[model samples]
Target: MSLPPRRPRLPLRARWSAGLATAFALALATAAPAAGGKARAAEPPYEARLAPYYGQHLDWHPCGKPAPRPAAGRAAAARERGFSCAEVRVPLDYADPGGAEVRLSVARKPANGPGERLGSLLLNPGGPGGSAVDFLTGYAGEHYPEAVRARYDLVGVDPRGVGHSAPVHCLDGPAMDRWAATDLTPDDAAETAALRRSFHGFADACRSRTGELLGHVSTAEAARDLDLVRAVLGERRLDYVGASYGTYLGAAYAELFPRRVGRMVLDGAMDPSISSRRLNLDQTAGFETAFRAFLRDCARHEDCPLPAAHPAANRALAAFLHALDRAPLRTGDSTRKLTEAQATTGILAALYTEAAWPALRRALAAARSGDKDGTMLLSMSDAYYERGADGHYSPLMAANAAVNCLDAPAAFTGPAAVRAALPDFEKASPVFGRALAWTALTCADWPHRATGTPHRVTAPGAPPIVVVGTTRDPATPYRWARSLAAQLTSGHLLTYDGDGHTAYNRGSTCVDTALTTYLLTGTPPTPHTTCH
Candidate 1:
């Protein structure tokens, strides 16, 4: 599925979430460009003036030490896999290359084995807002097959407004704590107004603190930046492995540089053709599918968290959510109560990967037992949201909103549109439907307009690209992968009939081998390669 909103994403309440950690954002927006807005004109042909950037060499240094992995492991894991951090200077606004320029933060883990280097394998884990720098060294660099690593240097770039690039700073911890806890499932006019105020405040904070950068963080610009990064790395064509939202970014790059696409793998593919509303609707359905799978798996296990679950897991889940909605659950930190929103988010976080299912079971059991810890619900929510131990929050969500709202037309015009859509959203997913419907409104108030349309990305002359989809992916749906693969001129579809947000290295040697072989040999999987 395309990481939409920000995805290819769900809405803000859904968030770049797949959490408050595993929460999938509310995928959203209605069709086409907004009323009274003009599409951005095609970029000027690559001009001579851009050579300074494309040709400039980056000064590399040891990547900076990450914040200690909060004793809680909420922050990214300690980046033990070493990589060189380099600064790439690219135009803040590509339309005006000579104007102000921003320095993008990039990291590289050089080839390890004794083999000819096959250029850099640029890596991104999606999020529009996901950090590629840490990803390059942490999970990716550490886990990529040794053979693939021997031939290609791993590269990561924190797109213009994300991570170490010109970071987007909005609200601080206290403000974000309130923002994250704002209830999307509003009951009364007062609650509705409060939620609106929260969305409004978030939008206002971003605009106030980073307005100059917000409008420019569009995926198109980020794609252009990707090209510059490619050229600067001395690679004539791009080789990439992008997941989740990264799939959309990778697809954009291929569309922009069809001729320069050497090898690409879009795991958890996103359909660039849909509107934000459709993205939300599809993701709602997608999550329900994943959640159902989780239910079956949990119910069969001896250690399943809910002994009384199943036969009707959806009803059980709904009841659980409703229980929290009635009264905030007490927590170890007396000051922090697990509100419905936080509880819902915590539950969603575990749905990202099956490995988290048991943990979810355990957390839920404690909460049901009325443990003051409120179980690990709040903790899991905090992890998915990237809440730090120091009470600070990363700018990921803020930047996620910035890029998402700018990339697509508004999914829900305002509260009324959302109210009307609730039934459909609920139909899509009884558990997550209502909250998701409300999040589509997050972008209706965005300050900028979209430059892209819901058009197919054929990448007409690009080299072969690998597009992956998991049958029961919780974030990007499997159909999106099928759709994206069909759209690309040389796209190869690799299906993992499995669960989780992504599929490359989760557990299937079948999927992993297919991907690494393609990356190493320049051979795409047969047009239709299904790995079960």
Candidate 2:
């Protein structure tokens, strides 16, 4: 979700009709017959349901269902860390309670200085695929303000199809390389054809490789699984913190579990109401806004890649990218070419942080001089979907594509559609429009049809939820934060006039203070709050 490679709209125009036959056949096989009629045969079981109903949208309460305690063998491990790990079985499709099941990995860090520790505070890091357990053990367990950490158990569960929970793998390293290197903006018929082929190839590869789990990995199901974790952890209500995509998950949980209200914080919130196309386009503009800020700083520095004396560094930067679009330069590496796509990705990587600005200036300077090494590193940063040595990739990029495509509609069908929309895109982000416009084309041929549409996330009767917005956030956009805050009755907007992806846990006294206070005392700051 970060802008590193800062990187979706319609139901009819959005969907691909190529796989209609298979989808219909599957649908018929799974469609439930009318109840109590002579031909009221039961439709296929939940196993046949392809639409995912997992994650933040369902009512999930603690099942009070006892589970097998961790093996006595792990006693020493628990004694040392004051935590234990367990597993819970949840339906692959929540709508079909009697269907096949999947195991969810759950971890519990019991409270340290508690007076009968309050309920568990579940945590999710926001990728439809980020690892929650990793977030907890890595940061939430130790870095969360002491007051909140001291009174409640921190529970982390990697949502279905993410991290350790039966992860989905779609491509090998070489195959992924080809996918990532695919040309984004096709200028003519031949290139357009190539773009379509690449799109289809990506989708087909995902289907042939990881089709089974694609239908089971919705956000709604993940929410229900969380509820089961809540019950197993013996918490009466869920106390939690979710960031980025995690905020969407939390809001989804509130919509489904208003009665089981508890303390919850959704930092850097997303508005579910935005269409895929709109989301991508808006995000493109957001990155442009952030890039301008970076350029402004660069214009003042002596080492600025685009010289400040020129008084047109930003324009020059844009021209350099355009020139690269026509002719890619070679890096020292024989295998790597600094194509426009790679250069655009590098620019996006810099957009994520002020700390990255200097590096970006250096990289841009290097690229201007026909050396692509700096740009290569920036592309690498955006492609951080995984960490592997020898330039290998984990299944994350594939999985990321899988989850995102299934959850939402495609934004553009081909280069022609994108070309038609170029003016609008340019209006949004003259700096990065074409790259982002091309990026939106990836989902054009996704195999699955989404079950829901973008809609406002409002969970009435829920406790106060704090929504954090960075004034110049490159990824989620500040306006999205503002809109999200306005959408929720319980939402309190906390604005950080800064640059970067998210505000909290980064540097900012105001953000840290406000969030820490709310997480600890369950009291939100006043609405329209600003922290510079």
Candidate 3:
């Protein structure tokens, strides 16, 4: 969970594999001034400068053309649902209102009325790199609780440097393919060197291709952009539903503009107070927790691939991955072989949701049998990377690294730092520790210094925000949600005693009802509300 990491996205029944993509990145450094620190000091002029952006009208038009066949159906459905797209312009650097600007892409499905309209409900499906536009038109826009959708326009804005909003580009297909194959859990000094090169190369590529934009893509900036989008939509208060990293983004917005917060929901919430190193270690353990849950479920089935005993199962899985590292396995594709990194990624991906455990079992069994069925493992990894059949990748990974790296200082300064931390990491998860520890080195050579740091976000004046947590969520640990809820002045914790990356709409009626009720009526779940 380092290179080509997963930013949590809202899970959709039609796209579980894509939704469950999971990975980790760490940040550790001194705190920087808040996003609008000085600007707030000069409020009069600052507000005057931003007035132009806030006053601009949105010119919504038809969304882009639908793709062929299968995807066209979804596109047509979006159209029938009255989905529209627009762009909002915001300053690239809020500090300099007169400087360069960037356009954020927004998609909306207007309220389909049968009830009095309340206002817009902005949705973000994580991925500091996830395309909110896609999330809106493809899933949440139509699938959200009808009661909420009928009154609230479901809107999604692709944060700057993500998706259709001036996306960050780094490695091309071939280069990305090679980078993905690079061994992360190095076994020797030479291997460690190679691993370092891969990370440095990625950072260099991003700096070279994305230039100044890379430095401006931090989560703070994205939060400011969110405010701009909120104002442009003519919404006096920001009503948002953000998952995974989106939770952090939403939190930032609340911290920046507490008065404007309204009926916000942060599912699979992250603890902003933790350092990047702590975040990585916690996420590694989280995946281990998820994997154990998966193993327990798998053991109930006769076709389970690993040993039934937890220790044996863990050892067996580790052994299998090590085997792949030693000798890559052939998949259905002629040119590609399933490497340890990809296999690890695939395993973590499945651990995001219980629904994919059966598939993971099949994939592991096939790989162990040395059958072409191993391609399933590779496909899962590709999905986590958002890599398409044509070998091109969505800018998800590039933008994930860019935003994450800029959010805080690198977790590890270099290989030596990672090496020293290995024991603690290995203790976190025997299987994932070393790899995740090494992943902390990914941003060591990033061109820009981090603009923000790990700190508590206590949006003092914000209204009640429902913070949902899944007990065994792989990407965002359950404790993070607790921590986030505890940190916020008006945060309410909605506990879902279940598995998966997020809690809402994942078949927990208790979770869905509570969240939907809050969103529709501006009521937060009761404190310490637990749902099974």
- The top-ranked prediction according to TM-score is 3
lDDT of each: 0.74, 0.62, 0.79
Q: Rank the candidates by lDDT, best first.
A: 3, 1, 2
**Model 3 agreement with the true structure over 177-199: per-residue lDDT tens digits:** 88888897999999999988988
C-alpha RMSD (angstroms) for model 3: 3.1
Per-residue lDDT of candidate 2, residues 1-532 (tens digit): 1121111000111221211100000000011101001111124363244223222122333322332221223335333555556666777766566687777767667778755566677877666556565456444666666766787778878778876576666666666656555566667788778767877787787788776777767665566566666666566777888776777667767766765558887776676677777777777777778877887898888878775633376578778777766877766557767676556655675565565677667777777764445444435433443434346654445545665665566676656777888888878877667667766766677778655456776667778888888788776778878888888778888998987766676667788888877776788887778988
Worst 10 residues of 1 by lDDT: 1-10
Give the alpha carbon lDDT tens digit for every residue of 175-248 in model 1.
Answer: 98888788879989999899888877888888899968878888888888888898899999899888877888
- Model 1 segments more than 4 A misplaced: 1-45, 65-82, 305-311, 370-373
Deviation in Å, model 2, residue 223 alpha carbon: 2.0
Evaluate residue 169 in candidate 3 and report its C-alpha lDDT on the 0 to 100 scale.
91
Please give the RMSD to the true structure for each candidate, in Å: 4.8, 10.4, 3.1
Error of 2 at 154 (Å): 2.4
Error of 3 at 361 (Å): 0.5
Q: Give the runs in model 3 whose Cα sits over 4 Å from its true position.
A: 1-42, 65-77, 370-373
lDDT of 1 at 23: 33
Q: How close is candidate 3 to the true structure, as a TM-score?
A: 0.94
2 or 3, which is superior by TM-score? 3
Report residue 404 deviation for candidate 1 (angstroms). Answer: 0.4
TM-score of structure candidate 2: 0.81
